[model samples]
Target: MLSRARLIQRLVIFAIFSFLLFVGSQRIPLRSNTVPSAPSAPSPARDSSYERQVQFWKNLHNLLESNSPATDPPERLKKAENVLFDPNANYTRPDLFAISEGDVKQLQQVHQRVVQKIKNDNSSLELVYHRGKRGIVSAAGRKYLPTLVISLRLLRRSGTRFPVEVFIASQEQYDEVVCEQILPTMNAVCIVLSGILGTNVVSRLEPFQLKSFAMLFSSFEQLLWLDASCFPIHDAIEIFQSKPFTHVGLVTWPDFWSSDPSRFFNTIASKPEPPVSERASTDGGQLLISKKTHAKTLLLASYYNYYGETHFYLLLSQSDVGGSDKETYLAAASVLDEPFYAVNEPIRSIGHRNANGHLDSSATVQYSPTEDYKLTNQGINHVKDANAGPIPHAFFLRTSYSKMSPVNLFDPSRNGSEEVSPIRGPDGKPSRAWTAEKETIDSLGGPDVEREYWSHVRWTVCTLEGLQFKDWKDKEGTCQQAKEYFDAVFAPKDRR
Candidate 1:
């Protein structure tokens, strides 16, 4: 026990120590600055593959930088430089860049912390959270929405006695799914990969604006690849057994014919088509690959791309060669000579770049002049198990389209499925049947559906959509969690 004045001094010192301890408990990870890599970092700018994002970022850098920001010009340029100029910049051909509002700061900090933490200790804890501006933890801010409809549809379509996995890749379309709704789905694993990265202090949060297809390869390699655009009309495993087109398939979209394919494409292009690999151009949106083969090539390419090495270790097909993972994919395809199926014409769905093009909505509805899409006796009705024999039932393939019009504010247009091939139903009969898809307005409560979807998806699009995040590997982070979440709520805790 000291005297009064000395006691007061000690009290002040103790208060300072307590304050420092509080600050220590609230320590923010360097990776939370909204850049590439690191948990809880505000997502990324491209849900597209890594190679796609590389070029996307470069072109974006030119376009966005030239156009300049409405707010800050020089500072933005400096920030852009911070994004564009990597001392270890992989000046590899065609790799582009896409920087959203928050990526610059976040990735920078994350990089620093990872290095610092490594230096400070032999072992360290993961730093995946951010002290969000609004005082909400990263996990708490999310008020999950419902993925019931999609989950049920996919389950019915997949024909699984049990739940199945489905990855969700949207252009920031639905936030609740990313933030809330999708979190609860069981059996369906929504790989929330986006291609953009950004920070929004406004929401007292940082949001990612995905811009590329980079992470698609990541998920595909990890066996989390499922085309989100595909509606579950039938068995999903049937589709899976057929050789999965890991990248873009040979299928063509109405938006590609005679148009500059470069617009939305970071697609691999080998003119006259690589001989032996019977294929045409395709969209990365609905592609697939074998976990055993194609995914290996994709992973090899992704690793090289991430390392900034010019030549990738993997080999793809001849015609499927070019862009980021282009050469590697083409070489791989060539080696495999695996025939792939495309969801071409006749059956109709929205998502074509310009729906009214040569393969316009009307034309897709009426007929399919292109060979990529033809009526076939081939279709999938149910997911087959290892022991199940192939059934006579069939289905058709269709191109998915999105209606990007100003009139559809915070809304996406209704997608129609094409009547591709007329397949045989059970009992040795041909079936060209297709379910009537609900009108766009009725799909999920109207135009605001897009908004509702985006509310959760936008930020996720930037970070989770295409990044192939490690946490996403967990069950809770999957589309299947939807069911689990529901079960926990309605079912007994012990059962869950």
Candidate 2:
């Protein structure tokens, strides 16, 4: 219809118009067919949760910094300050720290109430233990309950006035059963914990959380925690009366393997320098805490427990040997610049009785001649020898050579009716029980003594269940040579 130049111009215009339409179509999202993109910003609930977590940690930091004791050394204060202010610090996991707005408010309220309670009751001291259920019906838990009962019985016998509190982490029905049946007999108060903190972590980490944040469940100003395995043979009240415990708020003992601090320190990523003192070894089985003196220490310990495995990957590894909690406690104490009193004299916590009648106790026990054996700066006597006084506060009785069945100790149906007794022979005679007269008679040279000694030695035979003890016939290479084999499997990578 038009000339050649006009036709060309018209076609070019149409092409440009089509291109413009295409660009417009691309810019405008299709409402019917297009999949909606996620919002760029976090939802209001998520935003609120994150802010609360941030605020929670910030408040905790402030609390630690402000409430730290005046006596705290400059190094410890500085460490606390650095950890609190560090922008990169993984203080808490957002999900675990605050599950919802309700959780956030509840945590704050509980924390405040606990703090207030501790402040109001400065003179009160309480003994607390934690028991976490292993299964719907826990066999190990049943064993532990009797152990706790024995310790409480000993404590009551020793005239301890402090109330015993048991923290049970189990189903509501199980808790009720324990409360109604077991706690009633023991005269102990039972508190059921929700155990929400660090629940996502491995099973072993649960102990760290339970022990580190023990104050959350405790209202007392001073708290003493005893492991279920520990048996208080004497009045533990004497321990609190001791100068070491009174002077220093936190007190612990050395581990059996207490050679190197570097082995433990290396397990922590921060790699805090161990204390210069000889008493740097950690035994967390027994701990005495003073709320006012060790509040910051407690917080630091809890923080380490929460973030320890993350910082030190070795803690999460198989070769850790369940020492991560102990390592974290020691590291936190060191960082806090707090003095943790380690009794110089061995506390006869773990005792082994051999067939020879000579007690292979922890290095701390000694023979005493006095009727009222005084507890000196040296550790308490665990073994009661001839002409020896009572062992003061002998906590642990380790019968590792012969494993006693839990069935012998606890009956869940009967609620632990079995009375505690010494290891007995087939003839019903106490195997390990020794009398001064018998020892004297043995020393006087008699054929009867020889027979009796041999009889005692025969009882030392290993009776540990599950593992078969086979004597190696090939005497050329001792099984002790397998130390390296075990070290490779169980030892930490750094140690190995």
Candidate number with greatest lDDT: 2
> Which 10 consecutive residues of model 2 have the lowest summed lDDT?
74-83
Compute the lDDT of residue 226 as modeled in candidate 2: 64
- Give per-residue CA lDDT, model 2, range 1-496, as digits (tens): 7999999999999999999999988895433322111110111122323334334434543443343222211111111111111212234211101023453344334334434443444223222212220100001132255334444554555455566656544322122333444445545654333332222322444545455544433435666676544433344555665556567766666543332333223322234443233332445556666655676566656554554443321222112333355655545556556776654333232223444545433212211112112443333432223223333323433222123322231122222321222233224333332222333223223234223322322221111111222221222222222233233333456995
TM-score for candidate 2, residues paired by index: 0.47
Question: How many steric clashes between backbone atoms does each model show?
Answer: 127, 0
Query: What local distance difference test score does each model get?
Result: 0.29, 0.38
TM-score of each: 0.32, 0.47
- Total colliding residue pairs, candidate 2: 0
Error of 1 at 180 (Å): 3.5
Best by TM-score: 2
User: For each candidate, C-alpha RMSD in Å?
Assistant: 19.3, 25.3
Which stretches of candidate 1 lie above 4 Å from their native place?
A: 1-178, 189-224, 241-278, 301-332, 335-401, 404-496
